[model samples]
Target: MHRARLARWVAGSVLLAAIGWLVSIAEAQEGAAAKAPAAGAKGEAAGRRARAGQLPPYYREVVSEEQRQKIYAIQAEYNSQIAELEAKVAQLRKERDAKIEAVLTPEQKKQIEDLRAAAKTKRQPRRQAKGNAPAAAPAPSKPAPATPKP
Candidate 1:
């Protein structure tokens, strides 16, 4: 009777251990599946990833063809409106510049030109002149020499 009881206890323990092992394996799989989607989650999570430059501009990973066409159409409409507005703005700026130029003296115009040259140093990077190599960064300015005090 004692041997029988001992065998039953061992069997129960093994059953419990097997169940625990199965539960752990199931939890591990669930964690892995959850991790992947969480890392590449859609909507704002995807947008933030793109903004951080971690992913490409288009983050609609599994978009259907119908949805893609609709997105393209919407983008086209916005782009057209943007181009129209930009052209109007450019025309208005040209008119404004002409009006301002009409008011300024030659000396003031020279000063404005100097200011514009200075502003250009703040710089949008220019494309490379020829080869595949990236354009060099602007040279560092030399520090002004200090005048010796008498």
Candidate 2:
């Protein structure tokens, strides 16, 4: 029992040290990036943040290997159900959007497309300045000026 406790303590200590080392390395890289203004450091840092895996960050520190495996198994079991629901939701959205589009006149639709293109053009220079690719913006929802009612 004493030996088991000692081993667990040693393992935990090593894990903590490794985590600390990794954190320091990340901080060092960030510091270097901050010092170099032309490097587009913020975009790189944002990309790194986005790449954090699907697991909660705490899982890396607190969860035992066995518990992690069990959690992964549970997630796997739910994944198929989640995927099926997501597909259904997507199909429903597409059908709903088609119905909405059917209600709009061709002129209104063209106007919406024009507004979206304008917004995209306005955003392009800002994205380029930030060293990021221009992403498509959602179409502006401003309804055309209501024609005077008959």
Candidate 3:
């Protein structure tokens, strides 16, 4: 008789656990289903904005398709120029450092190297965060024109 009672208790415990798990799964599924429509709407709105060239405020003056293309070209040109300038500056710094190293004590050279390393590390985190942050929100669209009288 005691053995039969123990077996029944074990069976009841297993059944309860299974039911709890299923209920939790069902709740999660329902929550996800409730959220999906809002998420889908947001995605569709973003798509429409993109198609309309409704970019962020910073780009307000350049949001038209033609203007955007021109801006891209200009940006590419500026990027190339900036890269070339940066390379030249780096080369100049290397030459200057070499000249200074010839005159500086070993301790002074080490200090300069430490400073350069510190600067590089400090800049890296800021650049990485900038890359990870969400894109800026787009500016509001212009009001629609009034319809003509019939």
Best by TM-score: 2
User: Residue by residue across 55-143, what tens digits does model 1's lDDT show?
Assistant: 22565787766665556544543443455555755775577568659878999999999988766654423334445446667635667
lDDT of 2: 0.64
1-150 per-residue lDDT for model 3 (tens digits): 788757856865676566556755775677567655577776754454455433346896647777765655445434434555557557755775576488788998899899997776556655666786444433345577799667
Candidate with the larger lDDT of 2 and 3 = 2
Backbone collision count in every prediction? Answer: 0, 0, 0
Maximum-lDDT candidate: 2
A best-first ranking of the candidates according to their lDDT comes to 2, 3, 1
TM per model? 0.41, 0.49, 0.33
Over 15-120, each residue of candidate 2 has an lDDT whose tens digit, in order, gives 6566556755775677567665456865654344345324566787888877765666555534544565557557755775786688789999999889998887
Q: Which residue pairs show backbone clashes in model 1?
A: none
- lDDT scores of the candidates, listed in order: 0.59, 0.64, 0.61
